[model samples]
Structure formats: structure tokens, C-alpha cells
Target: MKVSIFFKVLCVVSLIFLAGCTQGSAGTTVEDSVSLSMESETKVDETEKFNNDVDNNSEENGDNALKMLVNWKGLFYNPMVCSPYGCYEIMNRTDYTGNILYTDVVTRQRIFLSPDLSADHNNSSDPSWIDNTLGGCFLFTMDDTLFMSRYNYEDTPGELYCMDLDGRNRQSLVTFTDYNAPEGGIASDGQNLYMVLYKQDKQWLVRVHIDSGKIEPLKEMGGDAAFLTSAYGDTLVLKEIRAENTDSEDQMESYLSQIHTVYHYNITDGIETEILSWQQDKLLEEYSGEYLYLLDVDKESLKEVSLSTGEERMVIDALSAESINAEEIRSLYPIYDNHLIFDMGNDEGELKKMSVNLDNGRIFSIDPYTESLDAYGSQYLGIVGEFGDEFLVTSGTLEVPMDGIDPDGNPMVVDMVMSKLSVIKKEDFWNNRFDAMEPVEDVFLESMD
Candidate 1:
């Protein structure tokens, strides 16, 4: 008998509890009379109110009360496609009038505003008029300011422009004479900006002072490579792939084409270390603490490695090896504190979550989303925002053309759909477990038969 795929019933249950606790207030305009000091006060007051509601509702609903903070209405993008700064939500893709937006994973509010290209450039012409594009990746935000890299194709010498998040202050930071910006370069620590440049089979890490637009080379990892993934905290974890090996390039038909590795680079010491390597596709995810979770191509197992010590532990292993294939590893997210949420596909291509135990090698089915797989497989999942007892879930799907127009002559019905933000309560998540199943003891155990 085919097993019934479990839906994230906890997410739905949490949503029910959150709906009761949240109290909506009137929207405040950006030009409100509140001073900067008063603005801080207002934010605190709003946060308190949100927290109070969550606390009260969670208490009433018992353990099932996970709070849903904000049900923000805006466009969403795949986090995987995002730059190190974060993902950008296309406000208007057809006419290309979108903004680079980020959601507070906890509060679910569209917190940071990206610089508006059309408004900043003052070019009412369609976005197609521009040769090189901007504003489709994560952004770095500090205080009232945000920064992102823009590609200026029309300029005599194509350059990467660093502009304010609001599209006000624009300046050229780096000039690329014979190259273009690679995806996943820009990262920020609220004070400094780090960017990566690829040229002539070499990768250079560039550091730019956000205040002065000053550029400096930090280090170079040898390869015609693109930044794969990054995590920020006390130390920075970056993953890059060596794209050009003559022999490997020739054998492109094989699944393992390049050397994929993760580099643990220290921000204070400017030292770098190669932490891990694999022959096939691998993924690295950093959690709240110093733990880094590595998931390989086959969904058969997962390894949790500590950054402090090079020690590694196998936290999960394949339950049904035949049922779990290499292509089924869809998406991964750090859930709560210790648990990890991952999605995998069955033979039918349906997605299912397998909650793996961090302390032990235990796995159980959790939930499923109805959306079909995109070219890259499962949709990117992220925490929108969290208040007290509530959290929000935001998801974006592929665009579909619409038939309508606004009062302005600009086409109103661009295909970009605002993310579907669902409110979830903390109480709904059940901290339970599946019946304990022994892992494959040893290869020789079954051979004894």
C-alpha cells in the first residue's frame, strides 16, 4: 500500500490559533510626523501589542499556539535565486517596475524597501529599454539606508553601481571592463559590503566600504566560479564551485562536473579554510548557532558539522533507500531551534517534508504543498516574520499574464503575483515523533541471512 503523504498539519493548526490573537491597526504612512526617536517608540509599542496578543492567544489555545505575525501583501521570489543580500520581489516584471524587497522572517512584514529603478532613473520608458538590469537579488540594509549592486549596460564602460535602497544616492563602485557581475556576490554585515567578481577563470572577493564606495580585494578562490551560498554571523560561511577544469569540463555528461566546496572565512582575521567537498551536488545551510547542515544529492542521509570543531555527525539516514532517490532532495529550512524541515519527492513528483531529528537519526513525515515543481524543483520556503505566538509563511509561484490596466498608461496586469502570506500560530506545531525505526545496522547484518 502506498503511504499517505503527510501535509504540514501543524502549519495549518498554528494558522488557526494566530488568526484569533492578532489585532490590526491602521496603516501608517512613511511620511508620518513621528521623529526618529518617536519612531523607535512607535515600533516598540507595536511590537508589544503584537506580542501581547500572541501571548494571550497562545495561553488560551494551549501548546498549539504558534503565532502568525504579519500577513503582508507583496511579491515573492525564490530565495535560491537570491543574492547573498536576500531575494528580490519583482513588483512588475513585464514593464519591469518592481522593487527589491525583503521580508522579516519573524514578523512577515516587507521590512526593507529596495531602490526603485524607474523612479530613480526618471526614465518612463519600458524596462526593456535598459540593456543591463538591476534589482533581482538580496539587498543589504542598515538603519534607514539599504544598498544593492546595479548593472549599467548603457554606460560606455559597463559598471556595477551601488545605490541607496530608496534609489536616492547612486554611485559607481566597481568597473568591469570585460566581465559582468556574477549572482550571489554581495553580502553585508550592516557596515561593510562584500562582493565577488569572476574574470578569466578566476574568482576575486571584493570588499567595499558602504559609506565611502571604497573597494579592496579580500581574497581570491581559484576558479571560473559563482558564489553558491553564504551565511553571516560571528564568522562568514561561503560556498563556491570551481567551474573550469579542462578534464572535468570535457566530461560534462557526468553528474559531477566540478569541484564543489565550502569555505569558512573569518571576517576578523581575513583567514579562509576549505571545510567540505563532494563529487556531486551538495547544499550547506547554517542554523542559529555554529552548526552547519550539509545535505547531499541523494536524500538518503544528512550530516551536521560544527564550525568550531571540524567534527561531523550523521544526524539522519535513509529509511527506504529505493523510495528516496537522488533528485528528491527539494528544499531545506531550519525549523524552531533544533529541528530541520526538508522536502523530498516521491515517484509521482509530489513533495513531502521529512522532519529529521537533530539529536538522533530519526525522521518522520510532516506536510506537503500543492504547488507543482518548477524547473529547479520545490519552491523556496522561508520564515516571513514572528511576533509572539504567531509566524507567517510567504510563497511565490510562477507568473501568469493578466488582462487589465490601471489609470496610468502603464500595463496594470503584469504576471508577477504577490506572495501568498499565511498566518501560523505557534501552538499548532506538535512536538511528537514517529515510531522509532532502527537504522540499517551494518551492510553485513542483512548478508548473514
Candidate 2:
């Protein structure tokens, strides 16, 4: 009996990973080894996902135009190539700047919200190249008007600029004296805008009355780190990660070690309730009705936590018998109602799309890319957004020419990927078939330049 190429490669990868794991201390426990392995595996996945955004064409003079093929009004996503450290650089390593391009799904038109919003690279020797200051922006539409806040990490604390959808009627809304940075996550209730402000070990939930320009700090959320997950309808969800000092000798180092906890705060009732605590390095967030769903990528499972009782139950397991291909799911985005769209890729470099019924735990494998669209053949990175009974998705791959020179006169070719935006009817998607005659447009935006 002979081992297949796949198995051989898998074995080699495992061996090399184990060998690298031994570089730690000899007394490193099995738990630590497993944790390190999981972290390393996550990094490898991120690298692959990062690589999928490249465009392989060697010529740099091609026309980079986008198309408009959909007229569905809903929340469309401007896909950004981001990493664990910060925004992923395209073109070259020296190019640390990246911008998000938003599309008005209703008008089938693209919107350029900000020009100078970018990530600053902190000079860190770590292989991950963690970003000290990631680009921060709060973008959302309310009452037919778009409101955005562009905050530069390099600027002073209280420098947030607000603007409209057409880049007109811009004004400075807030300037910080010495608060922690705005997480760049914001939510609005048609009347007021909400944001999470943090300064070392403290978090504050605040809202700015859009018309009056009155800013009020609502609550002091105590955590080493906090994220404003979602703000919609009447409820807001926040995920807080706490740092506890394990080493009494060095109190500062103890705070470096942390655990995660989630909470739900109701704007109507003015009540903040603790929901669930996470064990793994993953963070789960998605609010639906009376429950908030939790997704753990490392565990390949999704759980639903009750907002009232603080109880949780596993809903879907990507590695279990019910999943499509039983493959690890990545980039799970929630559509309207109790539906979730996720990406699935295999070792053979094949990308797939899967949707799960959050209410029933049923999974459907879909191929909305049936219409002679540009797939790049290797991988399909799809971004699914909801609009009524239809979905607006942008699918494509990253390509690297494998030959080029860096700006600093060094030999380097960077990864560049394009997005092909299209619209799919909800019924058509669940039927496992896409109509070829339908409008399948390519989204072009000036921000990619």
C-alpha cells in the first residue's frame, strides 16, 4: 500500500510543525503544545486567505475597471484585505496603506467615503508584523443619509471627522483629549450614533446625537479590551476580553494574559447583561432576536447564547457529520433572518460557498458563480451581503505575478486581487442553481488604486 500525495504532504507538514513546536521549553505541557499548534495553523490559514486576494497578471497597465450588475438595496460590504496585525498590504510590503470601497446597492453605484484613511505600520521585529495603529472608521447609513467617522491612528485622540454618502457636508464631530482609541466600530439608531471608546483597561459606550452634535458617554465598560460587535434595531452587543495578572511578581505581565467574555446591552431598557465566556482564542458574535450566536473558528462550531438566561447551545459544527464536505468554514457572514453564509476551501485549492439555516441547522452548498464570471480558477473569495430576498456577493481571487521589483529597488512582486460583484436571488441560491441570464456585474472602485 502506498500513501497518497495528499497524505504525504499532510504528514510532512505535521512533522515540520511538530519539529518547530519543540523550540519551546522542554517542560512545555501538551496543552501548551496544542495551543501553539492551533495558533500556528490559524496563521497559515490567514496567510492563504491573504494570498487569495492577488491578481496574477504580470503587466501593471491593465484597465482595472469595475462593473455594476445589481440593484438590490441592503447592507453591501466593501471587502478589505486585513490581517491579525493590521490591514494587509497590497502591491508591496512597503505599501502599508489599504482603503475600503463601498457600493450603493440600491443605485448599483460605488461610493468613495474616505481618501486618506490608512493603516500605519509599527516597526516590530515579530514575523506577524502587528500594526500598532489600524485604520479606524465608523460607517453606517440612517434615514437615507450616510454618516461616517474617519479617525486617524497617528493623530491626536479627539480627531474624528464625519461626512455623508457623497463625501459632502463633512464636519469634525469629536476630538479626544486622552481616551483609549475608538475601536472604529459604530452603530446607529436613526437618531443617535453609538461608539465604543477605550483607554487602557477601561471601555466606555457613548452616543453622539447626529443633529445636535452632542456626545455623551453612556456607560463605563471595564475590560482590558472591548469591541463593539453590532448595533442595530434596539440592541447592542459588546465583547470584552479581560486581562488578569497571573504572575503576582510582575503585575503588568499578569495583565498581559487575558480571557474573553461577551455581554448584551439594551438601549431601551438601559440594562447590560453578561452573556457567555469563551475558552478558545476565538470570539463569537451575531445578534438574532433573543439570542446572539457565537462562532468559534478554532473549534469549528457555532453556538447560540440566550440573552435572558445566559445559556448557550452548539448549533452547527463544520467538522461534524452535517456540514458540507465536513470542511473548516471561514469568513462566516450573516444574511437576513437566521441564515449564515460561509466560505469553505480544501487542501486542493478549491473554494466553495455554503449557507446554513440558523433556525434548523441545515446546510446547503451553493455555486452562485455559475455565470461565466472570473473565478481565477484557483480560489473563490466571496463576500455575501443581504438585500431583501436577494444577496449581493463579490467573488474573486488574489494573484501575484511572481516577478517584480519593490519600490526600494528590491526584487519583490506583490499580491493583487479584484472583486466581481453580482446579485443572486435568495430562492435561486437555495435551489443550488444560479441563472446565467441574470445581471452579474463587476464592481470597479477607485479606492483600490
Candidate 3:
């Protein structure tokens, strides 16, 4: 009976040990499964987040896009208006290094869209300075193709060339035999490029087809006095300067010198109308719709003219006002219909920007146009152009790197300030709720009371 009891106790102990081992193994398996599931879920969440970010960026690009064409280091002139593709700017280079660069307005990526037409810049005196100024090249794009006019600054004439955006399949369009004034202007309407052709004693408005390279004379602009400034749509704007030198002993010779008149010609209607006329002065600074703003360049007065009615009135006479001098006003550019971006030249010679309402003659000071930034060296911020809801800016240092070497051939550097390009958006730029030190409503109320 005692031997039977001992065997029974051993069997029970063995069963208990087996059950405990099985339970521990099942617990480990369950734990491992749960850990693996959590890891898989985490990876899926990360992938989904990445995909969502991409989708959001695509959507934002589809809506506004905010395209801009920019050049670095202030090496090129301002580009043409932004197109659906991009903008074309002259890549300032030496004589043998002339090339046009295409910049994606949205991405700010630049691509060389022209072949190296640079001649030898290896002149003994400052070889790098040769062909370094590309201010003579003009670029415009149509239908994924770029049109470039490369010319020497000494000679105003240029050669027009057409090529793909990637600088492929280049073909010469037209070569002006005579001097082509830069002020004569070059404009494109997708179908044809209208440019001023100066041959001998006359100036002709010629239109060249992009695909066929056919040149057609559209209108005879005028003599040495009449030349084109800019073209909008089917209308061409020309400036006519006439010298009025009469035999008057009392009149000053400089006073009877030259008169400037701005005229508008319709390409479709063939009608010529005078927009602004002044005696040795600029009557029109800028225009919108049927209204044109006239700046009394000599008198420092602001006036508006109606093209339809021919009525004119003074908007502001700065000389008569006490707040600011007319001479102190350095620049005035319109942003919207009723607002202007005014630059007041301060005592430090820096341009201070302020917003002015044309209707009420109320002025509101904006934030300091530029901000000082401390980088590796000194830096500054600059305001470029102010659009309706956006403004272009640039920031760069005043220091010049590797300027020139002394007799010892050591690299020379100097303190200089330059600016790079950027864009900022301001939705309330036109509204009175803008972040201005002085509100428009408060100014209006003070004037009323």
C-alpha cells in the first residue's frame, strides 16, 4: 500500500509540471504575436502619413502654384512675366559665355537653355570681366519653346533665336540689319512676336510668326520721334519725343528742349490715340483699365487721367503737403486699384516703404521694409515687387568674396551687401486690416472730424 501511494504522488507531480510548461509556452507565443502585430501597424501608419503629405503638397500646387522665375547673385536683369512654363532671364556672363537660363517659377530650379555663344573672354586685363554682363540678352517662352535675343550692348541690334526649353533644336528667326533699340521693346502674343524694326530713317512694327519664321510688317510706327515702349494684348504703346526749339530769345534753351508724348495703337483696329502729352516731362507712370495715373515728374504731383473722358484731376500734391517732400519720394508703384507702394528716401538713403490710399490721400506706414540678419557675416533683407497678395524679396550679404588679388596674389575680399530672391504672401495687403502702424479707418476719421 505504501509503494502504491509513492507512485501515485510521482504521477501527479509529473502532470503538474507538464501543465505549467505548456502554459508558459502559450503565454510567450501570444506575447510574440501581439508584438509583431504592433510593429506591422506602426509601419503602416508611417507609410500612410508619408503618402498623405505627398497628396497634400500636390493639391496645394494644383490650386495656387505660386510660380516665380528668379536669378541668383543678382547676375541677371529682371525676367519677363511668368508663364505657365517659367521665365527667361539673361545669365550675365562674359563675351564668350553668353547663355540664357530657364528657371522653374515654382521650384526655383535653373537650367541652361542656350548654347555657349561666349567669345574669348581671355583678355589680359580682367579676363573674368569680359562678357560678364549679360544685360543685353532678352528671353521669353511660348508653348514650351524659348525665344532669345542675344546682342552686344555697344550694338543695339540683336539676333533672334528659337529653341526648345532644354536648349534643343535652335533655329535663327530674324536678324535686324540696323540698330534695334532696347526701348523699342519685344513682345509675344503666343502666335506672333511683335517688335520694332528700325531701318534707315523709319521705324516699323513687325510681327514674326513663331513656327514659320515669317516676318510681316504690321504698321509703320513713325520717324525718329516715335518708338515702342511696351505692348499689352493687341494694343501697342509707343512714346514720341519731339524737340520744340523756337526762335524765342526770352525762353531758356533747356526749357524748350524735348516733349514726351505717349500714344496707344490698336493692332486690330489700326487706330492711334494719344494717351498722355507733356513738355519735356513724363505724363503717365502706370495705368490700369480705362484709368491711367500720371506723375508730374517735375512738379512732384500725383494726378489721374481717364482715357475714355479725357478728364484729369490732382490726386496728391506732395510739394504742398508738410509730411513729406516731393523730392524725398523716390519711387511709386501701384499694387491694387486704390493702393500704391511708395518708397520714401530717408536720410540714410535707404528706401522706406509705406502704403498710400489714392482716394482719401491717407498714408499708412508699413513695417520696416528690410530686416537685419546675422549670418556667417552681415546680411540684409530687401523687398522686390509687391503683387496683389504677394511680394518678392531678396536677402544677401554686403561682403564680396574673392574680389581681386594684390601683387602677392592673395585673394582679396571686401565687405559688401547683396540680395537673393524670395516671395512672401500677404492676403490683407489691400484690406485695411493689414498690419500697419496706422490704420486707414483711423486716418479717415481724423480727416473727417
lDDT of 2 by residue, 1-449 (tens): 11111111001100000001112332222223334434554323432221111111111111221101110111123223211111111122224322334333333332222222222222232111222214443333432343333344555454554444334455666666556435445555546766777654567888767677667888887766666664423666677777666556786566546677776788777798776776434554555434566777666677776665678787876646664443345455434435666667778756677777877888777655433223224333343344334444443322323333555777664444334444555566577555521333222222234
Candidate 1 least-lDDT 10 residues: 436-445
Compared with the true structure, model 1 gives a TM-score of 0.59
Each model's TM-score, in the order given?
Answer: 0.59, 0.55, 0.56
Report lDDT (CA) for all predictions: 0.41, 0.44, 0.42
- Leading candidate by TM-score: 1
User: What lDDT score is found at residue 231 in candidate 1?
Assistant: 35
Instruction: Give the per-residue lDDT of model 1 (tens digit) for 1-449.
Output: 11111111111212101111222222211122112213343233443322211112112223322221111100121221111112223233333333343322222233223222113321433221222344332233333443343433444443555543334455555565544453443445556656565655677776657566566667776644545244345355566666445554457634355666777777678888888766545553533234567765555567877765778887756635535454667656533424566667767877676666576756655553234324445443344334344344443332334334555655454343334444445334323211211111111112112
Error of 2 at 325 (Å): 9.4
